[model samples]
Target: MKLSFNIALRFLNSSKGQTFLIALGIAIGVSVQIFIGSLIQGLQIDLVDTTIGSQPQITITSTSDDKLIGDYESRLSDISSDYEGVKHVSPSADGPALVTSDEENYSILVRGLSFEAAEGIYKTKERLVEGSLPENKNEVLIGTTLKDESGIQIGDEVDVLTSSGENQALTVTGIFDFQVANLNSSWVLTTLETAQSMFSYDDRITGIEMQVEDVFLADTISSDIQADLPEDLLAENWKDQNASLLSGLNGQSVSSYMIQVFVMISVLLGIASVLAITVVQKSRQIGILKAMGIRDSAASLIFVFQGLMLGIAGAILGILLGLGLAYVFTRFALNPDGTPVVPLYINPGFIALSAGFAIVVSTLAALIPARKSSKLNPIEVIRNA
Candidate 1:
């Protein structure tokens, strides 16, 4: 083993330029893999954060037109204690209503929530643009777009007419912007009690909104929740509600993997071809070694050692190159306000996986050339020389 390693080192050192070029090729391939993988992962994270960061992963709601979940408090308690991965569960009641201001009248959805529980699902307190969350019954928080369209000021009282033909005067205590224009324009936030009263829910909630520790696991958890609940109650997850988004993310991941696979294949081919040519150029030296009684297995191992060295050295250089590229991207790719356009999070496991695959693939690429080295005819080579 020592003899094989020494011979491999000597060969690589002797053909310094060729070895360097082959190593450089491998390095470039690996660096690109790291960069592309990290870029896609970061983009997916950002997309998810924007779309559902403040939204619930799973929701329990009534399936019937009554729009009321019976014994919701007990159900919520059961889910909180029994389900794994369940984070925060918030009960909310909402319904369509006519919200009229002095200047305009618009149809909008009115949502009622408990302050602390609502914060868990929507981060409502953090997103408050004006005033605080609804502190008492009939005091509501309005969406910014709704406020602007209706020409309603913070202290204005709005008339809310429920579907049941009941009219109630509600105070606009605060304004919020959820970033989604549709949500901002058509949603009114109120207290759980007020919503139940407005919707005639009478001691019942329309649904339970819940966030989970792992968003991706929401679907499975939702299925489990549904099984535990009655037939009239249904559980839905964010993934179910956003199928198109999940499809796009999956497609992006597949394409990225394909690109990385092709690049790795190219790197493997380059290393294999270089090692093959090296064997041909050094046939005479190999024949001499065989004639001097160096075993075929040991001869084969020389090329294997070369592969190991190249894989290790190149992968290290590739990791460093990848890190530098990531830093450059994050530094320069910024929004108008100076925040990163796409956040870059480099996982150590991903780096390790790339390097490990490169080393294994590079070693495998040397097998054919290594076998050729082991099969050289000493006498024939000497005669040819």
Candidate 2:
């Protein structure tokens, strides 16, 4: 084995250009695989994060005509205890209200939440662009668009009118942008106590908002939660709410896999063709070694060792190149606010998989040449020469 390896090294070292060029080809192929796989995966992650990761994955709402989920604390307790996947549970009272501004009434959903609990899902603190969260009944937070349109300052008083003729004068304590235009223009936030009072729902909330560890498992979790819930209530998940988005995501994943597979096949074929030519080019050297009583197995082993060395060299180069390309993309592909258009999401496992796969393909590609090497007759080669 050692003799075979040494011979393989000498053969490769004899023709440095061929060795380097073959490895370079393999490296380029592997690099593309890593880059495209990582890029698509990153884009998918960003899409999912914006669509559902930042928001509630599961929700519990009432079927009753009043549209209120009663006994929510008990339900919250059950979910928090029974479901290990459940990350955050926030019971909220949400309904429509009008914000009167200069003879025009702007309609918005008044959402009441337990700030600390809701923070896990909404990340309210991070989204707050001004002032602070509402801490008092008289204080509230409005969306950025609402704040802009109404010209309402942090301390400005907001006149809120309910559909049922109940009116309340509240002060704007903060402003937030949820990143969705509809949410920014049509949502108002306040504490749970205040919303319940405003809606006159004693000890009851309209819905229970929840986030889970895995966004994709929301449907399963929600269905299981439904089975455990009272008949008067139902559990809904983000997946059911966004079917088209999920379909698009699955399609993207399929397309990415297809591209990677074709790249890998091309790489294997390139390595096989190059190594086959190497066998022919080194026929004289291999004939001399076989004439010196080297076994057929060892002759085959020589080409296998060359394949392994090439695979190792190419895989390492490819990994570094791929990572560099991804880094450059993130740094250069900026949005208007100087953020990367597609934020890089690096998975160490995926990178490792790509490298390992390239190496395996390189080794397998050498098998054809290895078989030919074993079958070579030293006597015939000497006679021809």
Candidate 3:
């Protein structure tokens, strides 16, 4: 093994330029894999965070009438208590309402929520960008999108009129930036008492927002909730509500994997081409080594070592460059509201996987040339030379 290493090192050092080129090819492949993988993962995280932050993990509602779930809170509690993975549950009432400002009027989804019950469950209050959450029955919290569209500022009074012809004046206590493109456009939040009062529906709720301990268990828990619910009520998980987003994320992940596979194949081809050329250039030397009683296996091992070295060098460089690029992207990109667009997260598992992939490709690339070099006839080569 030591003799093989020494010979491989001698060969590599003698052809420094070629060795560097081989390493660069491997590095480019590794860089593409790392950078693209990280970017896609980052986007997935952003989508999940944005969607989940604005919507509950699971929701329980009425299949018959929107008021059924709210009116049956006690029965809902009984069913929710039977589930082990439920983190918290809060009742909500939502309906389409007209919100009018001095400058403009817009239609929005008015959601009625309990301040105390929804604090931890929905994280409704934490996203407040301006003013405070509604403290009285006549106060309201508007989404940033609504605030922008209507040009309503904090402390302004907005008239909320229900579809049932009930009208009430609400003080704009707060404006919240949920960072959801769609939700921001049409959501108006208010205290449950205020919403029920405006809609003239006492003790009624539209749905129940449920937070789960394990996000991956959402479907299971949602199924259990549905089974336990009254026939008139329905249960839906976040995955169902955001099906398109989840599907798009899954597609992106698969695409990223496919890209990495292609990149590895390209790198493998490059390494193979370089090694084949090296074999031809050193045919005389290989013949001499064989004549000196070096085993065929030993000769093959030398080329394998060279390929491995090239792959390692390239992969290391690629990882560094890819990480640097990811950092740059995360640091400078901004959303419409001038906040950071996406969060960058890199897992150790991904790094290990990428590096292992590069090494495997390098080893495979060296196989054919190494085998051919090992089979050279020493006497015939010397005579031909």
lDDT of each: 0.90, 0.90, 0.81
Q: TM-score for each prediction?
A: 0.96, 0.97, 0.82
lDDT per residue as tens, model 1, 1-385: 9999999999999999998888888888889989889988999989998999888889888888896887888887898999999999999998999988774679999998987877888988888999877778899988888878888878888898999899999998999999899999998999999999888889899889999998899999999999988888899999999999999999999999999999999999989998999999999999999999999999999999999999988899899998788778988999998988888879799999998889988898888799999999999988998
* Window of ten residues with lowest summed lDDT in model 2: 144-153
Comparison by TM-score, 1 against 2, better one: 2
| Poorest stretch of ten by lDDT in candidate 3 | 64-73
Quote the RMSD, in angstroms, for model 3. 3.6
Model 1 segments more than 4 A misplaced: none
Q: Show the colliding residue pairs in model 2.
A: none
Clashing pairs in 3: 70-205
Worst 10 residues of 1 by lDDT: 96-105
- Candidate no. 3 TM-score: 0.82
